[model samples]
Target: MMAQGKAIAVRRERVDESVSGQRIDNYLLRICKGVPKSHVYRILRSGEVRVNGGRVGPTYRLAEGDEVRIPPVRLAEPVASGPTPAGKPLPVIYEDDALIVVDKPSGKAVHGGSGVSYGVIEQLRSQRPEARMLELAHRIDRETSGLLIIAKRRPALTALHDMMREGRVQKRYLTLVAGRWPNPLQHIKEPLFKYLTPEGERRVRVSSDGKASHSIVRLVRRWARFSLLEVELMTGRTHQIRVHLAHVGFPLCGDDKYGDFALNKALEAEGLKRMFLHAAQLGFVHPLSGERIALQSELPDELRVFLDHLDRTEPQKHG
Candidate 1:
């Protein structure tokens, strides 16, 4: 076992084929077990870390044969049983040789990072240790639940990424906003710019200098104070639906970020603990088979129950 606080030598490692194409920070995180993320980033920014004898940003992808300078990092004390397996098995919606589609529950992240210890991918790996490759095809917010896809092969992962980038993938979400939806179908073509808050939390806002974003929101139902809407993304952007709706005066229910905080607090007291957003449907061509595939998931029980509560308390003002 490696001793704690021992004077360690700066070592250089050659990137291997197994870790190729992964971000440098991620690669370091995997090998530098127990090192704090801030410390890792600190070394990178201070030029202690190098790729081919030059400083590279955290997002740099590692290629085979690239030499990386690794600084000595003190590992955290290990537990009795090398860190307990993270997360649990989730409900699988569909599975094949190339992919695995699961009904992800709300409050669970797709992958672990940024203070999250484990997520869907980690849990799935723990459950299927024999599987050679497993990676997320896309990501949804941790507060959002529903159909999520995981690629089982590298080629499938690459193809899925291409499909999403070319706008060939159709992602549909269900959300309950704070006001009555005005239109049956509305095309929201607002550009979104990502920004960080004073506390370093990620956020997005509509700005002319931002990336082009498009969302089609169709009214599904309406109550006196809330409206259920189906949101389709024509262009994928971070927090696209949440930002777009909030900008147009319809913040999502239970959304802590870019939402009415007062209303959210009241919602929590009323039994809604999570954001009212879910990835309800996805349509795309199978990357390997060239077959059109469409999948849908029903509203989670928590969301359905909340909607029922609204129906019982607030009379419908619009359809």
Candidate 2:
């Protein structure tokens, strides 16, 4: 651990392979111990921190062999806490030297921040203290459940990120949406813009001046008032699937952010207390092994039971 107390003299660090490809902001957060995130950003904005003898933005990705100048900063002593309680191990879908895939449950954030005290990554780290490196390869919405990847090594993380950007990773989600879907197969290409609301809530919407996004929707099943769809994401954007479906007038069943609010309330009474989105499948080539990898996760019992209820109460439609 770095020293925690009065401000220390500036120091330089040589980026190693272990941390290569990580964002500079994230790197500072890790090594600065108890330094405030705001302080870190302040220094970056003021050019107090430099990389390779030049100032870089917070989003800059560090490469191996890069030299970093860390400015002097005071850090508060970490608060003493009681012995950490053992955390429940996440369900492992697959694991190797390079990466691990786990079945993430709905309602749990992938990592801690904002109002979340701790999240999946924190719990996993607590469970595997001996691991040298563990970082999220990708993220899913907190209300979305399914296969989530965590890279065990820095090289694998970089490779996985590249694969996602190049559209080599195939991600599929199962969702129950309001109203019947008309087409058996449809491609939705919408430009999405992300913005913050007046109250400071982050949101995304379909807009003309936004980045191009694509989703392939396949009707899996249908009921009188609800449709089950398998959506394959071609471009990963914030709230891409939810925003796209909702923009097409088929909001996800329990999506509070973009769905029908009144319908969601009734859904809670009907026992579908959470969003009906599940990351059902992921297919990609192994980042380091040169082998193909495919993983799947089953829908949670609540979603399944809700479907059964619909079958018993609502009229069936051809799927």
Candidate 3:
């Protein structure tokens, strides 16, 4: 139900030929984009939405000539209990000119979704009030951290987006495998397919025939129990690294998605928090300047602490 505070008058935006065949609720949600579907439904269920002054069910489809009326609601109002900007994001690296790459910590999502108030991009907005533009060049899973790119201006955004589409953006990651890897250097040439569950969760897995995926992983260090590997992806699938690595029997440390829950729980009890993967390196053409650039993020605190624990548990192996 829409909030009981007070109904505010809302005029629906018009849609023409392009969106001629969308459902009413879908159209309303698009017009009220960013407003939660629940909120939209709240207004709808409370008799706040009407077509030509007549209450309409959510499933009521729309046609060319329909007058939609939305009851009082200010869509732009910030959600209640919004967090202060600073507490929301942490930046590990910053640069002047066209971009800023942050070494994000685990647990903080790359972009805010679900119940989160803000993500990395939202926090970075506060750092540059003068600039009218800022956006993420690429994304890393919320539980994963490393070099995350942010385009500071429209030109940079356009250039970077083009490069990403052309596959010129090179991303390298470092991950701690759950067990000693089978090969010193491995390349998995597989195809990937993304499956979305009914609950809205997305999972990517390997298939015999799907989107062509390939990545070369080389052993960086070996311990009595685990191995650190440098992984380079030639094709970027949703959960490519996590899924591929796990498919080959060496899931990333603390990767609850494709990794072992028992191991994650054991590590959590030992204060080994979050997933253990990092966007160790990222290289791309400068969106505006056309200069070649590569950025790296030093391992974060949580990763450092966990590695230190491994060093202590099996010093000889680290030696």
Give candidate 3 misplaced runs (Cα > 4 Å). Answer: 1-84, 92-94, 315-319
Instruction: Write candidate 1's Cα lDDT for 12-59 as tens digits.
Output: 999765456778998788778778899889998888999999999999
Report clash pairs, candidate 3.
8-72, 146-279
Q: Model 3 over residues 9-95: C-alpha lDDT tens digits?
A: 678745443344446787678667556789888878888888767887788866556778876665554458755576544665656
Span of 10 residues, lowest total lDDT, candidate 2: 77-86
Name the candidate, 1 or 3, with the larger lDDT value. Answer: 1
Error of 1 at 251 (Å): 0.3
Separate clash counts for every candidate: 0, 0, 2
Tell me the whole-model lDDT of each prediction, alpha carbons only.
Answer: 0.89, 0.93, 0.77
Model 2 stretches with alpha carbons more than 4 Å out: 1-16, 23-25, 37-73, 81-86
Residue 260 miss distance in model 2 (angstroms): 1.1
- Candidate with best TM-score: 2
- TM-score to native of every candidate shown: 0.80, 0.87, 0.73
Where does the lowest 10-residue lDDT sum fall in candidate 1?
1-10
C-alpha lDDT of residue 258 in model 2 = 99
What candidate 1 gets wrong by more than 4 Å, as runs, is: 1-83
The lDDT ranking, best first, is 2, 1, 3
Q: Model 2, 211-280: lDDT tens per residue?
A: 9999999999999899999999999999999999999999999999999999999989988999999999
